[model samples]
Target chain A: MSTSQAPLIPAPGDTRRRPLVVMRSVSKMFSSGTLALSDMSLTVEGGEFVSLLGPSGCGKSTALRIIAGLGDVSTGTIDWPSSRINSKGLPEGDISFVFQEPTLMPWQTVFGNVYLPLKLRGVSKSAAREEIMNTLATVGLADFADAYPRELSGGMKMRVSIARALVTKPKLLLMDEPFAALDEITRQKLNDDVLRLWRETGITVIFVTHSVFESAYLSNRIVVMKARPGRVHADFPLKTSMSRDAHYRTSEDYRQACEKVSNMLIDAIGGEEH
Target chain B: MSDHASAFVPPKTGFFARNRDTLLRTLIPICVVIFLVLLWQFIITVNSIPQYILPGPLAVANSLYNDWGTLSPALWVTTQITMQALALALIGGVGIAIFLVQSKWIETAFYPITVILQVTPIVAIAPLILIYAPTTQVALLICAFLVAFFPILSNMVQGLKSVDHNLLNLYDLYGASRWQTLLYLKLPSSLPYFMTGLRIGGGLALIAAVVAEFAAGSAGAGSGLAFRLLESQYRLNIPRLFAALVLLSLLGVVIFAITSFISWFFLHRWHESSLKREN
Candidate 1:
């Protein structure tokens, strides 16, 4: 009634076991002549929890944004082998993005915010009600469907943001430091919820973060990058502690993984990328 | 819409406590008005000032009652012109603002002209409008519209341009069309700014209409409140003049109240300005 339903996201999905996305020698240069990314190549397997670990100005967020088609790569192309998610109007399994901030429309209710992706895809509010409600329920915000974004607490707002992202049922979910703002406890809870959601959805997630502990805890594979024209310093696979329970966080192996990732990250920050 | 589901209004406290601030706000003004009126009445009675020289509040009220037949029609005329002009101003202002914001070149080309119209006094131009228009009412409406247009246009332009870039990017990331982005995002964001323009424009519209009538100098029949006020002044009917002034003032207040209510209604749900809180 307001306007035509917008295509919420461009979903180009693959049914194969091949890499979902491949970025070969991707580089990004700003208009002001600052190089954000320098020939960083990475391959993302479908349904993998891959963390882009880097400091500020390391272009981790920029890489995620480029994958989501929100930013342009100065050089090289991002290849989606199975689904060609071009930057245009089309209905596919949408690629959903969660920014550092919740990025919920303050004017909309929690329900309306969740309904946005579907609404953009030309789904009417009444038609998309069930999906939005289901997603909200999943995020434990079913009771807050009518509340405004302003009325929500920080963690609750982040949940709402996640709900909005999940409502589209995207094959790939890209998040840039989504829980970097909250307190440590809320962050831990949200991290567990994210892992749960990832297992449940089987969606490919490329999470960007600067924290060594968060990277160690969340991802089985971590891509460590360096600043001053960001380039990937190393990509290593870590042994998962199985479940992300409190016991896992307190486990000796978990501490070892964090320390190992922390040393690699410190080396990335201190060592030069050639 | 599930809006009603979340119509979670905060619980009202006791009548006296809940409205203590509002009550004080209203009570103090009323008390001051009463005291001033009483003091003026005493001064008039003590000095024995004639009604023609300075009609007291009672005399003004009496004039309102006795000359209701003469003044009501004039009051209606003034109201009709003011409202019509205001409505025209709203359409013109909002329309121009949208078009201007669509292209920077268009805004650069036309914005200065609006500023030119705004900076120039209406009084200096009203006589010219009266000379060009087919009727005195048309002239008044044109003047009022000219006066009311700039505020809505400028405020709306600022509002449309002031949208958060990240929100715009969010819409873009979802493949939202330009129209959908504007409708779902920019329009809602601009509503608060538009409300401010409406309130300012409403008062300016009335002022312009009155000034235009004074400039037109048209007598009899379709004469507005300002014309009646002038006529009363010319005839030394001070009580009738005060009565006309009172009606005009009341109309201005009603306009302001309507605009404020509209602002609150649209923004009470989410905006910081209109949201209700304990503090």
Candidate 2:
């Protein structure tokens, strides 16, 4: 299948001008002295789409959590470029996260769930309604503003979660296998949607996934990780010129990219067995 | 032709036929109630029993109508006490449950006291409470509150603690404050359990109020239903006594109905308790 290239329209915002997130040889060891991550280092330029690919118990989630400030690294420092510059040149308004489960507030309506971060940041609903609506529309959930999480389907619920993360418009978005629970067809559809959002919004995303195809399809660069004192295994760049479109899945180059990731994962898993 | 006709024919029994077993199961208790009532009326008529020994259903119904004016006021007094006590119990019980959830030391120290209060017979303590509690009404209220509060507090504390660990972790990831976690997640998650406790507590509160009144009758206030019950027994007004008993039973039923309604109202959409099966 011939790869259909997405029209390389210039993104309205230039995120490449700034270094959005920087991780400096971070390591995490639990109180039990079990090392989850060791000397991990990565830099996410603004608007880049990167994937952390690994088997179960790999520190992909740990890395994502560390970036979000939810988990502290036992032995290293992470410097996120804050949007606002203080007198000391410290960066701010840096990160947001999308958890595996939607983690939506069950009692809240879809609109309310999407509006939470803004509300936390002291933005009134009336003031942020336009941005909330625009984000909801971008995620194809414009009509579900009044529906509660229980009323939504799995895919729809995840869409709301994505919308919530994007509403903040943070420089860096950390997703920990947000679509892993979805069926293959739904997962693929959401992958396209997510890539489209990332392209349009120009937000740097560091997505964690166990699926090799998912990692290859969405990421410009894929960082393969190994388990048991998790460390970087391989970094692969997609040679396929296909952009974030459905045709990318049918492209021969896309299949080769997926196969390459699958081979690396098998070796990673094999090394764990040894 | 006969084979074809058989192929096209539908089964004679419908969906209700499948539920006939459940229908029979439901009718057994109802039939038993009717049979018992009939037997009591028969025994009273055949033995020519004195009204004081065993008043028939008709005699009770008649007395209820005749003394409706006097009995109605006493019933209102009992109902008012039950409602007030239950409201106070709900407030105190949920407050304490939240406190217990917030502090491990408080839970360890005071949980045993709550259990002790629950098991200690109100009958044993009602007289002492009446002596020390300044007013008889306040004593009765306290007794009722004590009886109703523990079940709610215990059930709610368990509910609050049993919130999904993953969901709590998600909140932590989002940097939600403790207050936000309680208001947005914990309280809503604990609601169904709280409703269950409230239902149990409602009936219990009514029982406690009546029992306390029986143990320590009206002090300065004229009299409640319990005093009327004693007065009827002393006067050999068997019918009036029967009327008071019926009123108490009805009051218990009313409390149960209200609590169940509130539970259904809140949980009917998302909860299993209020679900109705078409089949």
Best by lDDT: 1
TM-score of 1: 0.91
Over the stretch B19-132, how does candidate 2's per-residue lDDT look in tens digits? Answer: 888988989988998899899999999999999988999899999999998888888888888889899999999999999888899889989988998999999999999999
DockQ of each: 0.55, 0.28
Regions of model 1 farther than 4 Å from truth: A1-16, A84-93, A272-274, B1-25, B277-279
Assess each prediction's global lDDT (C-alpha) against the native.
Answer: 0.87, 0.84
- Which run of 10 residues does model 1 chain A get worst, by summed lDDT? A1-10
Mark the regions of model 2 whose C-alpha exceeds 4 Å error after superposition. Answer: A1-17, A84-93, B1-43, B166-170, B217-221, B234-236, B276-279
Cα distance off (Å), candidate 1, residue B22? 5.3
* True-structure RMSD for candidate 2: 4.7
Q: Under the 3 Å rule for N, CA and C atoms, how many clashes does model 2 have?
A: 3
Tens digit of lDDT per residue, candidate 2, span A1-274? 2344332222345436466677889999988889999999887776668899998899899888777666578987877664663332334345677889988776578998898878766788899999999999999999999987878899999999999888878777889999999998999889989888877776778999998888888887788999998989888666566565777778887888889999998888888855
